[model samples]
Target: MLADPMVLILMYFVLPVWLIAGFADWLCHRATHIESTTGAKESLIHLLMFVEVGIPLLAAMFLEVNALVIAVMIVAFFVHEATAMWDVRYATTARTVGPIEQHIHSFLEMIPLMGLVSVVSLHWGQFLALFGTGTERARFDLAWKQEQLPVTYVAIVMLVIALFELLPYVEEFFRGLRANAGRLVPAKARRREAGDTAIR
Candidate 1:
């Protein structure tokens, strides 16, 4: 399957989409952090990204190309689109996205569909084959014989994006924890410690 031209084409096409979208998301997240927003919309957008990339990657690696898989992709696509629209609405209404940022957001929103199309085109034959007689049942078997490289590459890309989205939150969480720890400690205890140090 890796030898197939369609597969090769999709493999190449998906990389830029992954990079561009991931970068846009990272930029938006950085802005959100800098502005110190509530992060509700940012959180949802990242969650949607995880779902959009994660499910398809897993399905391509582990599951057979079949009607059920296509159905799942369709559902996931719609859900992602819905969340994406909501994200845009929230950002625009909240004035979180500025003029320059809107261009990045537009590109981020548009390119995912091309990625989806690439996946579907690569599996188009299998999808058509399912419509033939006696092939309607779901296939849960692993696609070890299929082209695993694209799936692996996509998985790595998603992992990178996941890290980009998560690292800031992780840092913020630890910082908050440390600050709260300080706040929880008694002021009298801190002052006593400080006094003991001064005396020493």
Candidate 2:
């Protein structure tokens, strides 16, 4: 329940940007899954991505903007945009990745980042403790530094790695990806031996 003009402005400001960014990510992700490596110019993915990255920074341009919120939003989009850029780079290389792999990768990256962003937004309620959302006083401040800073910083940094380093570190990830996959296969030889003994 937010009623103040500032909250209203932030809502108006954030919703449209979220819609645009989410749509862009959806389209780009779809293209990666369908075409997997060949849909660029025809795709509005890049245009949408730019909008996404720009929105939070745009919000920050005002002198009254909340640094903590703006920082979270900016870092969130930074991670997202960086991921998009890496996808483009990897597709250009056209190495071992395919549609399923591309699809799997994009979605996997998004899940946790979204959760961290959620925490940043929700904690606004906790710090204010006013049973509502949006007000002039809701502007992010250092009043709660002992509580907010470290958690937000760590979350932002983790998302940044996923976005920026994900592609370059593909080889390192693959070893884990394959290892987890192998764990799923079960010990086939043991099963086979059991079956043979039963047959006898």
- Give TM-scores for every candidate, taking all chains together and pairing residue i with residue i: 0.64, 0.31
Which stretches in model 1 have alpha-carbon errors above 4 Å?
Answer: 32-35, 129-147, 150-159, 165-200
Clash pairs (backbone) in predicted model 1: none
TM-score of 1: 0.64
lDDT of 1 by residue, 87-166 (tens): 55544432245566667767666665665676667666556655664434445444553435655676875676557645
Supply candidate 2's per-residue lDDT for 180: 39
Q: Worst lDDT window (10 residues) for model 1?
A: 191-200
- What are the RMSD figures for all models against the true structure? 11.3, 16.7
Instruction: State candidate 2's TM-score.
Output: 0.31
The sequence of per-residue lDDT tens digits that candidate 2 reaches over residues 31-64 is: 3332222233212334344445445433432323
25 Cα displacement, candidate 2 (Å): 18
Pairs with backbone N, CA or C atoms under 3 Å apart (clashes), candidate 2:
none
Question: All models: lDDT?
Answer: 0.55, 0.41
